[model samples]
Target: MPAEQQHCSEKSAVTNSSTHLPVRAEWLATHSEMALDPALPVIDSHHHLYDRPGSRYLFDDLLCDIRDGHNVRATVIVQARSMLRADVPAHLQPLGETEFANGVAAMSASGIYGDARVCAGIVGFADLTLGDAIRPVLERHISLAGGPIDTGGRFRGVRQSLTWDADASLTNPLYPTTQSMMDEPLFRRGFAHLAPLGLSFEAWVFFHQLSRVAGLARAFPQTQIVLNHCGGVLGIAAYANRQAEVFTHWKLGLQELADCPNVMVKLSGLGMRLGGFAFSDRERAPSSDELADAWRPWIDTCIDTFGPDRCMYGSNFPVDKGSYGYGIGLNALKRLTAEYSRDDRANIFWRSAQTFYRLPESSMVMSSSNR
Candidate 1:
């Protein structure tokens, strides 16, 4: 067996007992069956890596999930401020995240973790509010990501999250209470710098803010922008009891955003706390079928509007782990897309991510006919 497989088997006997704040291994173990269509290739378009006070999901944790029965051939590491360097200047702190992700990519490439190349694309954080000043930071990320010890050329994009709300409980304390980032002149100026450097922008905003992202996409048609978490649909706290009202507005916003061809949507994050699914509060985990049924409307809307080529599946893992296991999460996606044509399903699973991130063609698991 491969070294990674051997290691996984040894640890399989030992259940995770860590009392992490958001993700409990005991809870995830409540449902253990692998999903249907396990052979479908996936790129896991969005996930995070962190080692924090109440939570810690490192390389091993990620690999364990990848080995949990899906053909996850690659992954894109989204930023969560996990490993920023405290020694660096405030703005330069994000470079350390890229460096750390590239190191993880290097480890995955060693073949010890099977063929799935985790962090095949690294999307680190950068404050685009810096305007023109953000250029050097972008260069630094590019340089470090392409350095000798890093992944050869997997650094793809930057994500300056604008996920916020007026309700204090719903918003991340670290983020400013801004109404719209796209309207900021300084932010727009900084966003313009991305296209010239061949970097894509990963935009994370609430469903209400979809029009803002649509405006940004229209303003900078040259830049490729990815809409993270199905445009960050909220169903928690203030928005909890009004699911019907929220969905009506959310669908309208999504339709407007879909008019912008430069944008793509990541079809995941349905299990997030912000969505108010409350999957974590259940006595036992829901099955893949249950997950598929609940997420179908939103997922189908994105696929129908964006088309399969512009819609890709994402795990949003460790965060999504708060509600469901990695296998069940992905299995739910498989069940959701079961009716689509083979090519459409392939696009949702892996091809869209490969094209959007500009991941190397050699890393792709294309069929002999395509070759």
Candidate 2:
């Protein structure tokens, strides 16, 4: 028998290692089964690593999470409001994103994360509506990120989230999405600049705005537009009883959006603010299966319309932790995709993200072999 297998057998007979062996074995076996392809590398297409309370989320935090849980070699650090100087353009007020990207680079420099560099292709912030100033803001932010380490051409893109709630009270600076941002000409110009820079655009909006996204996708055929959170559908009060009708409209809107070859859908953040499973008085977290169930129809519709190549899995991390932990959410997504062939599973979870983000082969480590 192989040394590892022999050792496992020996551990089964011993009391101390025997006690721990079952848990280890179960974990290893689960990981092995979850992978359809042992060769394809895994990239969490959408995930946020932040320094919030009661969670391990610094650069090293993410490294340990990736190393301990699965074969995540590289991660794209989406902007989660890092500790940056406050003075910048009003629209570009929260400048902490540059620092966060640099933080990921520093962790890479520490090199304790095996071959796993934080090849964090950043989707940093830029107020594309600023037109002439948009390029300058991007350059300034890029300069902030490039100081200590060679970023490996990892400045992948920008995400100007346009998530508006009709209820005027829903205005939170943390997530700013107004109807005006979508219809404005200057913002379109800002979005258009991305194609010239070879950067992709990440869109975050509510379900009603799916039509607008379809419109934007049609308008900008050159920009690789990624729709976040299954178009941010909300399934709580006011919208709760309308799931069927809402989803049907959403389905049709997504189909239209998918017609634009440049658009992709990220299967993430669905259950976070969307409150079907999170409406309890005590805030009980939904199980992986529960989340997968809630997200199934939307995800399936998106895959059917956009095709698997344009779809990718994202944990949406700490925000999702409000409802499901990273491991749980990923396992849930994996379970939902269990029926797929290994190649298809690989594409949904990892491969498509790699191609979309332009991550090199060396940056990813497959979980099948990790076991």
Candidate 3:
């Protein structure tokens, strides 16, 4: 386990030592800031829930962060390949995760956990490489997502990550993807199932692979594709110290994807250790100003390339928690988008995700403070 990926699962604790645990909560307390616009509605478009030996961020941990000051009304939990059924057939195993997340969502919708709705939109994982054979699994996951939440549908999409790199260090192992999996015939055959079912696709790929995503979007013009983590911009490992070269390539790739109208981008996830900013290396926690400054070059290019409507904010919490506190991450997003009109800000903050995931407007409990 990497030091930056501290959130754990039961399996990780046995193999990894305690040093890989997430940054201590006490360390994050070294710098704190009140939410800049506390009343603004938010939908954490991408995040995960898991429990590891020394680290955990289940429902309670997520709710604690929601209450930390941002008006995070709801969140769309992306798949982290957790809580899978051990005994089930390989194709049916992901059903366990959908059941687990939907159960948490039912708990949230009960209103017992305050105004927030966690896991309101569940993007469970399914092996697209399974090709057309994956239809039954996708159907079962959708059925599990059914509950009294909102009629727009709780199960929104699938995220296989597809984060491949020639650098062996960057492989997540969890995804088990072959290089250029998106370009594979079997993957495309499985991907063909999404739009017909009205589900979206979450593309988590490296910056170098943006052209692959654009190819996918062009192939399936009707399917909604979200490019995760600012196209998974990377700076660590073999990519270290070549910031200028990385940015020029990343920006060019983003420009090509921007032309694919079916595609959108998530403007968060810069906090990961893979991002190479090394904010966590500092003696004190980073202020929102520092976060905003460090994130601007990439974020601004994303917003400018995709526009606010085609982009949404995702905290990528717990995964990002290793880099900065939840409140500070969102506060920095607030600082970055302060200049946009109220409507544009609203789209980036919550509405883009709300509409993209088919989550109902009722899920957002706006503060009286207004935008």
Candidate 4:
């Protein structure tokens, strides 16, 4: 194993010695509240499926959240290095994740997990440094995802995240700082292959790197780019006391990014540890109203810049579950966008993701329209 992966494995073993802390049913039950606008359709645009030593969130965990009274009809699975075949070559390891996700999709399709279609879209990782040679890897993923088959084919995009920082404490050591992965000639060459394959690109860079995303969008105007975690606004470590400065910088960068018509923003991940929400430190989890108040400025700025059509709400679950329950996390999104028109709300909750991922039209319909 690489030093980073080995280190992470060792750390996870240590952490698992205690207990997995997230998705605690008891803690979430304390904040029991009815689903906000239960009729609203939702397609959780970004989430993960991982079974680490300390934390294991897979099909059952996802089903628990989906059945929490919200109308989550489908979901998009983001890559998280789970279920990778250890026997495979380094480049081919990501296929195992897609295969794992496809199995989850198959399970959800059996109607055993209620109406929510988990892993309706699969966003796996590929080393874009391979440049054009990455095509074969992508084709392998598509073929394994069932190609054009209706029941299992849901390979949507690639998410080779560039979420690195020089401050070691602020970033994952596995993704060491690259300074400019997005601007690299080799990376661009690999990224250029997506549009032709009808695949989108999920950019998971931090706030300081938004300029690189902007440049990428401008360069690949035909390709669809989804900005993960609202440009991954960092509020931890060196950024902890610099909220004001970060906001100003993030806002300006967002405005520049929005100038690219093909790019969309995911309104989620605010509850993450790196986001600096501090909700988990409280005596009790925050209510929807409190979360809405805390997140309004950033969410409003995204909506104002990208409009409802380009802004979709993602749960970023299991990751966000570290701080808040799935119910509370999604309810916060509901509370945040309550002031928008019904159509706009629909766009954020589901339509934007549906269109962006090109998911099945039949599966995207709202279960109940009486709200």
Candidate 5:
């Protein structure tokens, strides 16, 4: 609750054993037996892989996960703070994440990762406050992704988080709370730079902020914008008796976002807190149905508003992994979308992400026949 400790300390101490420890193939294989395939190619539009000294999200683990996971051909690797070295300048503080992706790209060149490659469409950071400076910041991010460390070279966009909320339960206070960046012209000037480069914009805002998101989408029709985490709905103790009121507000806000053509949504990352699913010792995991119930309305609404062509699946991994395994969250998505036609399912699962991230259909090292 203190300002110094704003981040939720769910799994704070990720021991070396927890990092590099192999997720037994037998366990996943056995779990796979209960999993149903919608027979679609899925591009998890938003997942995070952090690096610890003895961790497995390194190149070897990433490739192995892709090979063992469902029909994934190409994926867009987003920035996490794995490479945030202390010596980098404050303006360039975010570039460390971009550098980490480049490292993933280099290892990708070894040609062992089956058909799924770390498609180079990176969404690094640019401070919207430094209007003119943002352009170069973006340019530097792309350059970093294209450097020798990155063999895949998929630089695509950036995600400047604008989630500022006064409600303590709704956000991590140490990080800036819920403020809509789109409402500010200075930030908009920085945002305007992405259209010409074919780069997309990723947005992280709370449900109350969706109206402003709709406004941003209208202002920048050409700049593709992706909304993360179902507009970040939160289930606070204050709303225990009145869940519907918050959800009602969220539903209406989402409708406004659906009005924007350039804005797409990623149906992930609500299970931990917003969904009111509790897990203490890793044995009391939430079921797929529970996860699906919390998100189905929002996901279905986004699909109806933007259609399946704009909808994409994302794992929100490591974060969600604390509550459920990678395969579990993904299986919940499959279950949530089971009612749709095969073609529609394919679009939501992969085709949309392929076109969105500009990932190649074929791989030079590994063969991705699923696409």
Candidate 6:
């Protein structure tokens, strides 16, 4: 069995709401390595900043990671039920997240945060199952994110999490989802609004569900879809002791999803307990090399199938923090792609995210050490 990993177990009295396996800061500190390429610019394509009942990872927590040593110049904040509005109608509540993220963007834009432009692009959440009623909600989100989409809105897109599974442990009951959630007519109708608004979509489905994502991509080729967490690899519960089977299914899914020209993938999240790394089982936090070795088979396959142009790196932080530190997590990514051409590496590092999210020009500045 994989190392018992915890995530957002809010129901657990001893643990925080935001952390699954509470990160052992002291254990992680036992081994550390500086950024592999300090000058190589990066845009952390996907990260969440949520303040749950027992957990809090706000702007300050993220800044600490940014200060850890990577040359991350900009970031795209993905939605995670963060800073939601309590006063608004149920459907209109997501707008508060956009407002919160954009406010953070404004703070980073002020230059006081130094080189990093936090939340340069924001991906807010809205239940697409709401169908056309979601249009007004999306408009309000766009408004909160700052401006018009074609003219470069900081609001990049929408992510209605589709992660689901038969095993109870593999899924999150907090967000009720189904195997056919993607195929629902009402969901499709709401999703249709994205392309017209010039907005992109982020899919956070599991490996077994990647084929469904492929179908959705083909159904809406005009809309840009970015697959999250390396297509949501599974390692616990029914997926345990079956790495070979899981990898085979995952590879086939990757190939099928890659056939959709409209879809892209993020090379992140393998550090999570769901990924079955079981690094947490060790007496100490795993080193970057260990992470790189365990992750290479998965991350390498993503780049191989999707190519650099359609691939970007995301920290998937705080969630994966249970397995490794921010710097170490990124170092594993850097080490995995150490042999790629500089331009290709840049795509995985920052360019692809900037392109996909329509991030600002400030994030495009490449440092002299970008070799």
Give all candidate RMSDs, comma-separated. 3.8, 8.8, 4.4, 6.3, 7.0, 4.7
lDDT of 6 at 105: 89
Which candidate's lDDT is highest? 6
Using all chains and alpha carbons, the TM-scores for the candidates as numbered come to 0.92, 0.80, 0.92, 0.91, 0.82, 0.93
Model 5 scores a C-alpha lDDT of 0.65
Write candidate 6's Cα lDDT for 200-234 as tens digits.
99999999999999999999999999999999988
**lDDT at 30, model 3:** 71
- Model 1, which residues run further than 4 Å from truth? 1-21, 147-152, 365-371
- If ranked by lDDT, best first, what sequence of candidates would result? 6, 3, 1, 4, 5, 2
How far off is residue 280 in model 2, in Å? 6.6
The parts of candidate 6 lying over 4 Å away from their true place are 1-19, 150-152, 365-371
Model 4's C-alpha root-mean-square deviation from the true structure amounts to 6.3
Model 4's alpha-carbon lDDT is 0.81
> Which residue pairs does candidate 4 place in steric collision?
none
**Model 5 worst lDDT window (10 residues):** 1-10
How many clashing pairs in candidate 2?
A: 0
Query: What lDDT does the true structure give each of the candidates?
Result: 0.82, 0.64, 0.83, 0.81, 0.65, 0.83
| 1 versus 4: better lDDT goes to | 1
RMSD (Cα, Å) of model 2? 8.8
C-alpha positional error of residue 283 in candidate 3 after TM-score superposition, expressed in Å:
0.9
Residue 207 error for model 2, in Å? 1.2
Candidate 6 clash pair list: 6-20, 6-21, 7-20
Candidate numbers, best TM-score first, in rank order: 6, 3, 1, 4, 5, 2
- Between prediction 4 and prediction 6, the one with superior lDDT is 6
Of models 2 and 5, which has the larger TM-score? 5
- Please, what's the RMSD in Å of model 3? 4.4
Residue 364, model 4: Cα distance from true site in angstroms:
2.5
